[model samples]
Target: MIIITAILQMLRNGFVLSKTVIFIWGLVLSHALVSNGVVDVFADFLGDEKYNLWKAIMVKSFLEGLSAVLKVAVIHVSEAYIGRFKAIIFCTGSFTMGLVLLWIRASHLDIVTLIFAIVLIALGTAGKEPTLRDFFDYQLREKVKKNCTEKNEGEDKEPSQEKERSGKNDSAATNLWWSTASIIGSVIASFFLSSDHWGENFEISSIVMGATCLLFIIGIFCYYPEEKPSESPLTIPYRVFKAAIKNRRLSYPSSKQDYNNEDSDDASSEDFFYRTENGEVHLLPRHPSFSLFLDRAAMMNNSDDEEKVRKEEVCTVVQVRDVKNFCLIIPLVVTLFSYNLVSTSGNTYFVLQASTLSSYNIGAFDVSIMALFAIKSLITFVVRTIQSRYKVVRPLWSIAVGMFFSVLCCIAAWQVERRRLYLKKPDDDIPMSIMILTPQYFLLGLMEGFAEGGLKNFLSDRLYSESMKNFVEPYIEMLLGIGKFSSILFALVFYKWIKDEINHSRLDNYFLVLASLSFVYLGIYIFYAKFKFQRRRVAVPAETIQETIERMDELLQVEVDINQ
Candidate 1:
């Protein structure tokens, strides 16, 4: 719900959705219909009949965490090889297969089948995330380009036509319609599969998953094909790493004259570093910080043959700088894992805590835990809207504020748990109203609004190379997966001491521990943001490059005509 809500808000703020994004969201909505309601029920079933509560919790966490890891691995390996549309198709197909297996397991009450299905579902769901994000980003860039072109052309147009033709409002509305469809699908599924209708839940969920697969197939042609690099995308990074190591001991030029000396007189004046025998530029100017040794890959030796140098050194300075760019952002990315660790607790332990409280009645219907997620989503949307309107654009500052709220969320949970423990008797319902948990949920939503948006903006703006931009989504997803996996491990270790039984559990202590970690992480992030990180220079516009090429082509054609 948080993720869906965030994407919708982003769309409203002019973010675009491609067919890949729509297909991925469809699969997600299908999975949510099953997982959100069924997983808890499945866990309860196991706890009540087959296993202990701790074991059930471990089983659920392990499947989810392992799935996340596998998802990252698959995306990292396959994203370069496959187109985004094909990847979506493959992932959605996997999801459909997993749903089939899940249906079988549910019907037969077979634990082994259930376990296998869980693994398959994890794999399918994991791969879709980064791919969908990349597609959305691409579409967003296209939208920005269109808007820029329109603004440039608006000067010559009549005011009425210009107003009528503005793409911004139309684009936003289109994105909103897609987001609304996604939300509506999830809500419909949730209504059919919620606790009140547990008996037919798996059957309904399987049908939804099948329908989602068909929907994805229908939209396969809707997205524009992502541009494929002429050379293998991985080649540059691999060559950079290899060259950095191979040239580690080489001495760099000591003077400006040495740096400027070239083996060939015909080298292009635009070349920042050495030029190849074939007239290709080899490098750009080196970055000033971290991984400075990579610059040695571009250093020219006085005795070296130009052809031999070209053959031996395949990396460009731009590629080396790209690697360095990732190095600079490592600290910030690592800090996010800490925030993710705290966030994981919300989905697992916080839900458990909420389940124990007296249910809130909305007239005839008692509000389920899933409904609380809607409340959080609503709050996040409101917060994001306000931020967008004010143009409060400091991402790092927003992330810092989010971290602070995360700490407060933990503190709130700890206090509530402490109170519940003090007030409740054995076998008695929790004396506190479920609404007491509302503040934590609201704070979490606010934290997500600030932190996630800030991180996305910061990384996208700071990355230098076009190729490197593709990596931002996978890298963030990897961190999130690791955070969830690590949190589960942390919980397991603490479980020996804290136990899983609600009556005897010291879960408040766990929340306190996370609160402390969040506080420490916030301090470290602040220090890194202030003193250590340096933003890369903005990349040249692709449109400008394309125009220059077109102009050169026109001049060449004119020269040919004159010669004829």
Candidate 2:
């Protein structure tokens, strides 16, 4: 979707596909090839062949969880030192190396080698993914800006309408393209992994990854370089935290008027609330609610040492607001962990379950279990289209809908498992058709598209400062890592309870537990949506306030639509 979007965007702009865009596309393609095509199958192979069912689940889960953590850590530590492009290249190289290692270890079947390969792959993946996403977003923004500039110059009237239409079309095109690529990757990977005619899946994966690395390198020169930040991006959040702590004793202004009344030494300055050291106005107005203490970070304090005061009060109101926005979104982000806990089981337990059921046959070809994931890609396209068509752009509401789907998926899976358990045979395949589980996969995919899309939109839109926006992808990655890690821990407990007793093991019970947990979190999400983040109506002219309220009400209506 991202690759196609960039291509369409370039086409729309009357520019040839830029080298940078191509390189980014290559990165995305390579990622799909490895992640969808190789990794899951390799993990499954190890589990089914080398170890028992429970051990296999643990291996895949542990490797994924650990790798997620490593990726987040590597990105955090290295992103500042190396710019996003370089970081992406570094990750791609690491992943390629890991693939090579996996190929070498294939015959030996050394667990240690496999572990090392997993770690390296994880590190590479973690580093590249967030940076890649941010890069795409950066490109999209630039494209939009360029289009707006052109529209403003070329068409004086209807620029807003044209821009809106163009933006929607471009976004839809990109999403469709991304989904298509993912589906292709999934199908290709499944074929190689499942078919005996394709020499070992690991070998095929290694070759694909190597080619992907080459493509990544080839496109490096084409990328438009972003200016490197003077300070570590990590420092912004830390500075906000420190400044807020320092000003904890300070009191907030009684009213917006009080905030505006404070006179600055510079009479020429018109702005209030927060000013830069050189007396420039900030883009965002002061937000008094939700971590209001952070407002003190931008408050000017009179000190004996002018230099000290300048240094201490340098943080912008926008920056403080950015930090507060992040804080506000943390609870919503944490909800993904619960969603992931249930979702991750799909790749492991669900796949295993499918394998035990009767396969779908189409003449000469038997459908691979991994190919079923294309169902998700399909559902995502449909959902996103419906969303775009109706202008249903409420991200949080989308997330809630996604959560609801996830709960449904769990319930469906539980029922399927319950039936399978009841109809168990000693040595034969389960009587149930693998297609019985298609609904769960479809729901899982819908959950992913909506929840992830919502989360991304929420983070990107809510941020008040452009400077702080780059952190959004990394924050998301960190949250996903946390979720993956937490899921592994939960899986371990569940595995212990079920423990290698294939027939006797009540995996259905685990799914039931997940469904119950999801329900609880869904209710909490509703509460948060309703009470925690209510829109504050700023004091203004009645007409202006009425318009603002109407806009807010429109957004709330979208939420209502999502619930319906």
Candidate 3:
């Protein structure tokens, strides 16, 4: 009876959680619809008024800036002495409220009305993410710093220049070069694929694909191990950028008088730590390393305690540091083609295979795709749960395997397409089994599960040592926006080139491209894993419990050294 009661209670809680997720999803969906609608309306109005492309661009940019300003203003208002959680809830509420207005007006459907409504909703949603992130990071920083020291009396001091070297310096030039090459190739591919005179003008698409593959090969050759640098004494970039940016001012001290006034007392360095204007309190560590400086800053909202301090503070800060190279650009760009390839793979097979299969319904909206996604989500949840229990298996391995499976699914689809084309069935409704589509979607979902989970953990692990770690949360959110934008680039390119000629064979070829790309990506990741330290563990001295206690007692009695 107790077990039954507990099960009932758990079911109730699950339902509540489901309702909350659905509500949030609906709100986001509504916002997207409204925002896009508004953009379309504005573009139409500009076109009607004969505004040139440059003028339209300027106007859009100005509107975006105005939206940003308004969002920032709201953040400041909400941030006034409020807790981080409250600030985030307030911002999310504001955006949701705007979305609610659009949902209320679902009865009316005019281009101008839709446009204005969406713009208003978007304004409420835009910049809220970054602002909320800033609030969270601010809270985390304070909580972590507070856990180290009990003193609320003095500010924390800045670490020295040597400490700043803990973070990795990924070469921005390499990233930029690779990203540029990919972009140029994409453009060339787009041109060749879209042009009707493809045979005469150029077979540029094939050439671009070949070049991109070559670039990946070159990256493998050029890669080299980076030497680990010695630990620094000081924490660099003491001032958090968000605070400075929010206030719209530089944080540098104005004069020597200001510096002296700030740290007025010259106490014994060993007796008392000096706190800087920023929240950091710096002191020398109790060892021989001159370059080692200890920073004791309160993590926001955390009480001072040893165990909690270890959890809050970054361990092996160098391993987790941020590197701002263009490594992400290629991944971002490739995802566009990847999404396009997967989305169109179904359509391509539909056209090419439908004519051949006698039993299949061609171009039918398989609602099963949605069901499959839900199933995939459930699978991911289970996998993640197991991962929590198991220590060894990482989620990234799943992602790598998922992509490989995707290749297999593509192969299966290609086979179906080839079979249909060759057999030449008499019936118009030649149908392939629904199962053919399942693997593709399942693989995609698996990819999403692994990629999303792994990427978050990877970035979080690395972001702490970044020069701008304090402001990283928001910028990371911004990078997501950039990723989405890159993905959309493929949609535009595909519409331009293959809208008319979207066939099973063409799509088969497309999936082949995606498979090749995924393979190369997997290889690069494997290579990186080989050179990079997977994780760091501290070394402990080996001593029996009895011997250690005896040595401790003797040392207390001033008897002898344990080493001797």
Each candidate structure's TM-score, on Cα atoms with residue i matched to residue i, is 0.73, 0.77, 0.41
Q: Give the candidate order by descending lDDT.
A: 2, 1, 3
**Candidate with better TM-score, 1 vs 3:** 1
Order the numbered candidates by TM-score, best leading. Answer: 2, 1, 3
Candidate 1 residues 369-420, lDDT tens each? 6665656655665665555445375877877888888999999988998998
Clashing pairs in 2: 1-177, 1-178, 5-174, 20-222, 20-223
Q: Which candidate has the top score in TM-score?
A: 2
In angstroms, the error of model 2 at 2 is: 19
Question: What Cα-based lDDT does every candidate model obtain?
Answer: 0.63, 0.66, 0.36
The C-alpha stretches of model 3 lying farther than 4 A from their native spots are 1-367, 388-391, 395-399, 402-435, 461-481, 491-497, 500-505, 532-564
RMSD of 3: 19.5
Backbone clash tally (model 3) = 30
The candidate, 2 or 3, that scores higher on lDDT is: 2
Please list the Cα RMSD from the true structure of every candidate, rounded to 1 decimal place.
9.1, 8.4, 19.5
Number of colliding residue pairs in model 1: 0
TM-score: model 2 vs. ground truth: 0.77
User: What tens digits encode model 2's per-residue C-alpha lDDT throughout 1-564?
Assistant: 743654455346433233445556655766776676556555456645546666667667766666666665555555566666677777777887887886666656577887788878877677655566666545654555566667677656676776675565544434444555566776666555662322356576667667766876676565555767355556777887787687677665433222222223443232323333233333233343456666666655535324644565446555666787777677777766668877678777787777677878778667766677667666766666555334375877888988998899999999999999888887745788878888888988888778777776777776755556766766765666567656667866777546564456778898899999999999888787765554422223368557767999999999999999
